[model samples]
Target: MMISNTPPPPYYAVIFTSVRTNDNEGYAETDALMSELALQQDGFLGMEHASSEIGITISYWRDVESIKHWKDNLDHQKAQIKGQKTWYSQYKVRIAKVERDYDFLKK
Candidate 1:
């Protein structure tokens, strides 16, 4: 499948999808924190997103180890726990490695 501004070859993409709970407290704060930390991580590259209720954020990373580190990061882990308990009604994370990619932009 063709995606806009396809990620460069040989990168890891962490696809995050979430259904937010309307009454959850600290949702925006935690979400923002996660984004900030992700950008600062060792293997961080870049990200793109299309979000609403069921949102998707694909973050590019250097390798599996970096991705795994993010997965187990203390702050992010706390946020994940909070999300499961109070923020997200449901969520799923999928990681994929891109060996090749292509895109077409309007001229």
Candidate 2:
């Protein structure tokens, strides 16, 4: 799902970029679960994701603390382990503060 209702600027964005391995055994299920769990997190703003040769999932949070909490979440940790072992070939995570943002929507 596309996350449209993002909060106003000055939030945090965790940009997860990954290259997948051929073995995708349980990737989809785990990914869906992670997204579901993130929504339940305290400072979650929203998320936008896309996948192809390289996959990118950008999750927005209220602050760095919230992002840290999500990173250390037990279930998420497990998913990380699984991704390291099976799903992803390589990945990079970058967190940045959204200083300003503007968008135009076509009706």
Candidate 3:
């Protein structure tokens, strides 16, 4: 389920930052499939970001296992390759735990 509210402390968040390559092949279709995969996963909290040539997306998970599962997923695996080969020139993935979080929202 989508939760706009803050997540509990001790959660895991994967920050995927990428710089896209000039060559884009089947990008739209693959991107859509990745979104679909995220929606189908139980641990997916939500993502917040802005994407273009450079992008950052933070995907929340229940634990490391969930994150690993997504990494090993066939479709995602393929997408990762496509990213390296075509979509992204370089990318960085960081997995971290939320020991503390602070946020202020305007309503």
Q: How does each model score on TM-score?
A: 0.85, 0.96, 0.85
Query: Where does candidate 1 clash, by residue pair?
Result: none
TM-score of candidate 2 to 2 decimals: 0.96
**What lDDT tens digits, residue by residue, belong to model 2 across residues 22-106?**
9978888998999899999999999999988899999999999999999999999999999999988899999999999988878
Best-performing candidate as measured by lDDT: 2
User: Can you write out model 3's per-residue Cα lDDT over 1-107, one digit (the tens) per residue?
Assistant: 33345477778889999898777669889887898898688777666666876888888787889888889889899888878888887899999997887877579
TM-score order, best first, reads: 2, 3, 1
Q: Which candidate is the best by TM-score?
A: 2
Residues 1-107, candidate 1: write the lDDT tens digits: 23434346898889989887787578889878998999789988877778776878888898999999998999999988888889778889999988987766799
Residue pairs with backbone atoms closer than 3 Å in model 2 (clashes): none
The window of 10 residues in a row where model 1 has the poorest summed lDDT is: 1-10
Candidate 2 off by > 4 Å = none
Alpha-carbon lDDT, every model: 0.83, 0.92, 0.80
Q: Better model by lDDT, 1 or 2?
A: 2
> Where does candidate 3 clash, by residue pair?
none
Ranking by lDDT: 2, 1, 3
